[model samples]
Target: MHQVAPDRSWPLFDVAATRRIEQAAQAALPPFTLMQRAGLATARLALAIAPHARRIWIACGPGNNGGDGLEAATHLAAWGKEAVVTLAGDPAALPADAKRAWERLRQAGLDLAPAPPHDCDLCIDALLGIGAARPLQGGLAAAAQAMAGVGRPVLAIDVPSGLHADTGAGLAVRATHTLALLTLKPGLFTAGGRDAAGQVWFDDLEVPAGPEAPCALLAGPPLAQPRLHASHKGSYGDVAVIGGAPGMAGAALLAASAALHAGAGRVYLAPLDPAAARLAPGLPELMLRDWSSLPLPSLAVACGCGGGTAVADVLPQVLPQAASLVLDADALNAVAAQADLQALLRARSQRSLPTVLTPHPLEAARLLGTSTPAVQADRLAAAQALAARYACVVVLKGSGTVIAAPGQPPAINPTGSARLATGGTGDVLAGWIAALLAHGLPAFEAGQAAVFRHGQLADRWPAGEPLVAGALAARAGG
Candidate 1:
């Protein structure tokens, strides 16, 4: 078993794919072999996590998940540890594999306890695995509550009970460490999965991935490119940032500064507010210009950082003329409000022009004409829909940012932390992506790399020091 980390990319499977893999593995192996492997893996991991614990509480359910718990309890008992096992469902209703496991536990001179111990060093949650589709009730509910109230480490088998293995939706048990068996589920890395499944570990049970294609991918660290000695400033290309109406000049300046720091050959700032130029003395490297003065056709333009209502005036020109474009913030809102701009945006795809849209959940909801809750309910679907609708790459920013393109499987970024919750971070990301685009990266790869690096900065931010947007923008290229 290996721990899941962000150092390398990993394939993510949905519930249907995981079930298919399980079925194929079971058909090829002897009866109950998979369960035995799962149980042994669970027991070994439990020992490794809490070796000194005398009492280990194992909560077993009515399905095969419970059988895995029963098998684990037998091993723990044989190892001279106090294995407290409790069955939350009727023993007579247990499945074939679980019945066999129950018999094995009985043969080991162990019996089910009426209740969990008042205290234990570790708690194993096996009440519901991938099959959990509804809220917990009865003995399962009580078991979940007990595990929560205990305040001890919880090692959940397969998946935390109640979390949707496909969409990462639903309330679930919060596990300190979750051991993903057979395959890694996408839900564990995105949406509520990141919070529900802490310190995720994976054991494939010695089975290889089947013929099924992955539903999504967990984005890894971007590959580093070395700059050549022959390269010059012009080799990187130019980036133009347009936005900053009135009081929100800081937003546009933040984007311009980010592009400058992120290795753009030349960064130009065009503010909607004429007075905004006076406020940007700190970034001397940024070339201040009128929006109409820049050659839009030759530049990678990042529009709508803080354009407010003024951004609507520029989209008509930016949409069709810019060589490549990244529409963010108010630009997205403008397009969501105007059908003509939406049509213009769609025409760019037909012209084979590269475009990327970076929208937070609310912006995405506005573009989709849906509620934020609906968009967040299935982030992957929402992102994919937006990409298909606009015929461009869509970066759905949230707890687990989803990057989707027209014909490719979406990617879930795993690099960021809550420190990014502060203001102007999205503006910083927009500029970072613009820099990558100016450097000649494709829209999808640019979004992936920028989102990964942007989050990695927050992930590596020094503890005790505040992580503000200005600092984040200044560190973008690093």
Candidate 2:
């Protein structure tokens, strides 16, 4: 069993792939061996959670997920713990492995026809797994709901029953602790995954990954640190914010401020709105530069912060010269509309320059020539598709902000909340990521770290504290 952390990435597997892996694991091991391991692990976890409780309710389903619960009941009974196993299925119609587990539980004298004991401390939700593709209704759904209505903790097996393992969608079981078995699931970190599966724990069942490709990654821990004794203002590197045409100066300036606060030694703004040079009254440190005079390929460039229509004409130049770039906001909209500029942006791949594109659902839809619903349906896949098409790192913003590389397993950022839905937050994120890129972080890592930090700042911000876009920028890099 491996505990997921940031420095190490957990390999993700899809439902079909994971089942194949499970079968392969079973091929080498004895019959019902994996189930026994699962049961033992579940019991150990339950004991640790509610040691003094008088009654332990194990809600069993019709599938193998239920069989695992039955096996757990047998073990708990053997250990002299008060185990109550309730089943929602006929005993004769279980899958082969599950049938064997049920037989073993019956042989061990641990099967219950009625509902589990009501006076429970922690209910084990073994009702569903990846197999549940639709909304849970009827007896099982009602039982799961009844368990939820009780103000107690829940230990879900494998996944939170109803959640889609790949997309993290659907009606999900609200679990306090989830035992992620065999392989870490990608769904647990994205979409409704984080909310449904809380305080995740992994037990790979001593199974080897073998020669299979992972579907996603856990996004473990910060790979490196920024605070060093020898670091100086120049040591961290500089970032230049370009965009904020006319009315949207605050957007461009927000990125600049975020970059400055997020460990960039200095931040320069090259605003498209010339009249407002020396604007952003409160941010005295942001030095203004005209779009043409500012040095490119020297410092990191955060472009497209409210660039609007003006960004279209300048991409021909920015795409060629900017060595390290982050494209976001209306700039992506401009390139999506202009084929020549799209080709120019594509040319960045040949230059080997680092460019990151931050696009929300609609912007990503425009770039992909698809609809927003398609993008939202499978955010990781959409982001990966965009990254490969543009030959740049892509940050698909929304629930479960997916950070995808050109051809790699995407990382689903586990942090962030609805509070970040406010406007100008994306601008702040772009600047912070640019700052990380400027400070010598890889494009993908810079994006993931900046996103994690951006959300972390929001998560930790004190109550009554204003979480405005400007304030968000000010909280970056720390």
Model 2: CA > 4 A from native: 1-7, 115-119, 225-235, 463-466
Candidate 2 residue-wise lDDT, 1-478, digit = tens: 5446544656789888899899899999988888888888888888887887667888888898887888887888788877888777777887877788788878987667586565778888888877786888887888788788876888888888888888877778899988888877888877778789887888888887777788887665566564889878888878888888889888898999999998888888888887768655478887788878777878789999988788777778888888689999888998889888888888988988898999999999999999988887778889999999989999988877899998788988867888898989999999999999889998999999998889878888888987898989887876
Residues 112-160, model 1: lDDT tens digits = 9999899999999999888887888999999999999999999999988
C-alpha RMSD of candidate 1? 1.1
Instruction: Give the top-scoring candidate (TM-score).
Output: 1
Best by lDDT: 1
Model 2 clashing residue pairs (backbone): 5-220, 6-220, 6-221, 7-221, 262-477
What's the C-alpha lDDT at position 377 in model 2? 71
